[model samples]
Every structure is written in structure tokens, then in C-alpha cells.
Target: MAEPARRRPMRADARRNRDRIVAAAQEVFAADGARASLEEIARRAGVGSATLHRHFPTRRSLLDVVFHDRVEALCAKAGEHADRREPGDALVAWLGDLNVYAAASHGLVSSLLRDGPDADLLKRNDDCQAMITAAAGELLDRAQRAGAARPGVRVEDLLALVSALSLAAEQRDDDEGRANRLLDIAVNGVLLPR
Candidate 1:
């Protein structure tokens, strides 16, 4: 098996610059979509274009970082939810959190799909999906083992169901309310009968 690539620690200033650029890029992308200008992002980040380019050479690279960071954060939240004693409640809570992540990810995901992804973006996308799937699988397993969830529920099924909810929520004026309602429906459907 291939060893995972090690990330070298960045110098303090470089790390700060990178963080600023990513934050700016996310805001710009949210406001202007993926075609948002890199120079504009650098300006918003309080960094020069050269520095932005040094950290993220391509628009796709910046998007990849933003997407990966969000997924990693979701994974962390899943870990927290999994630690809860009530397995069903944990799964439902994690899925609710996942719904929020999905909503945040909607714009970037749409842009990435509309534009052809580069090799690096595709690889990162695959890795992010794998991480999310693994987290969901663990939570689902716990719920099922506890007899809190119905038999035969799969992680992909939950993901797809939540994706639909997220899409529906995106179209609503009260997205948070709609998203939570949709997630509640999904959780109810998954729960085992008494």
C-alpha cells in the first residue's frame, strides 16, 4: 500500500496567508461563484496576487482546499456525534450536521460539476467522498447494532436522501427550517419500530 503524502508544516506567516486566502476565496466563490477572480480574492485576503498564487496556483486548487476543509470539519463533527451514548440520536444528530455541511457545499459542488475538474481536484474529491462514507458507515453500524435503526440501511442511501433534502432546502426561502424538517423525516424513516 502507498504511504499517505505527508504535509510539510508551513511557516507562521505563510500559514496565515494561506488561511486568509482560503477564507477570502470561500467568500468570493460564495458571492460570485467559481469564476470569481483570483486577483479579487487576493485583494480581499489582504495579500498580493503573487502570495495567493504561491499558496494556490489555480482556482481549482483553491476550491479543492475549501471543499476538503469543510469535509474534514464534518468528519470531526461526526466523531463527536458518534461519541454520544444514544446511537440513534447520534446518527440523527450527525446527519443533521451533515445536512448543514451539504448546504454549505452546494454552491461549490455545483460549480465544480459545471466546470470540468482537474486531476488534482478529482483525486481530492474522491478522498473527501471516501472519508465521508467511512464516517457515515461507522455511525450507521453503531445505530443498527444498537437496534436503534432499521436493518438494511446503507450509508449511501442516507447520503443520497440527505442530498435530496439539501437540494430542496436550497430552493426554499427558509432553508434551515426546511432542511431540518427534511432531515427529521429521514431520521424518522430510519428508526426501528418499537
Candidate 2:
């Protein structure tokens, strides 16, 4: 007789294993950088090294998966902010969140940007940058129209400023406070005379 088909998408045990692996990878990556070992990841996940290899055949695979996930999340947040608020507010909120995300992913981002193969992976999704830039541009236009921002600010310049602030914040022990302050300065500096 033919075997019965599985009712659900992922089996319960398989789901658990996948969740564990992702969680373990997050911790390992945070603590050990991109070079974190699969063996250590499996150990932390309470699975065998073979299982880890089965799930992620290479370190780049795992990093790519996580990085793409983060980028998607950031993009989604930007979309939501743009939809729900004034463009200037949306830009400010998104920029703050982006700073935090960048701080968290600094190591992986550096690795991806510096490594040739990984840089290709990062650049593969140009859509994310386009979305971000579009959102920033809309916000900047709104702020300028309202006379709340400088007339000639460009989204690219704002993005570079945000990135620099994020990197600087990452270096400080009080990163959260510093990031917030830097974001405040960025927003305030863009404002036109009351």
C-alpha cells in the first residue's frame, strides 16, 4: 500500500530542529563572528555536527540566510513606517531602526562587504537598497516641503550619514544612547528654520 502523505508543511520535530539551529546560529554569530564553526553551532543547538551540515552545508549559506532575513525585515519596517506616518517621521523612525540593525549586524556586514564572494551575495538583492532610498527620498521631500528640513538634502547623503553614525555608535559602550543622540542630531540638522 502507498504511504499516507504528511498533513502539515514541516513535521513538528523538524520545525523544532530548524528553530534551534537558527537560534544557535544567532548566538554563535554574535559571539564568534562569521567564522563561527558549524560544530559549535550544532553543539549549542543540541544537535550533531552532521545535522548542522545537513541544514547549512556551508558557513556562507547560514550567513546569507540570516543577512537576507534581516534585510527583508528592515525593508518591511520601512514600508510599514511609510504607509502609517508622515514621510519625515517615517524616515526618522526607519533610520533609528536601521542604526540598531546595523550595530547588531556589524561583524557580518563587514565580513560580507570585505569578502569578494560575500559582497556578491550582499549586492544580489538591489531591491532592498532601492526601497530604502525611495523611502528616504519621499521623507526628505516631505520635510523640505514642510520647511522642516533643508531644501537640498539627498537620500544618499542622509544614508551615508546614518551609516557613519551607526558605525560610531557601535564603537561606544553606551551605544543605544549614543545612537539615539546621533539620530536626533541628524534629524535636527536637516530641519529648516522654525
What overall lDDT, based on C-alpha atoms, would model 1 receive against the true structure?
Answer: 0.85
lDDT of each: 0.85, 0.76
TM-score each candidate. Answer: 0.86, 0.75
> Could you give candidate 2's per-residue lDDT for residues 146-169 as a string of tens digits?
666788888899888888887888
Model 1 ranges off by over 4 Å: 1-9, 116-124, 174-176
* Deviation in Å, model 2, residue 129 alpha carbon: 3.3
Top candidate when judged by TM-score against the true structure: 1
For model 2, give the RMSD to the true fold. Answer: 4.7
Task: Look at candidate 2 and tell me the lDDT of residue 39.
Answer: 87
Can you tell me which runs of candidate 2 are displaced by over 4 Å? Answer: 1-12, 112-120, 125-127, 138-148, 174-176, 192-194
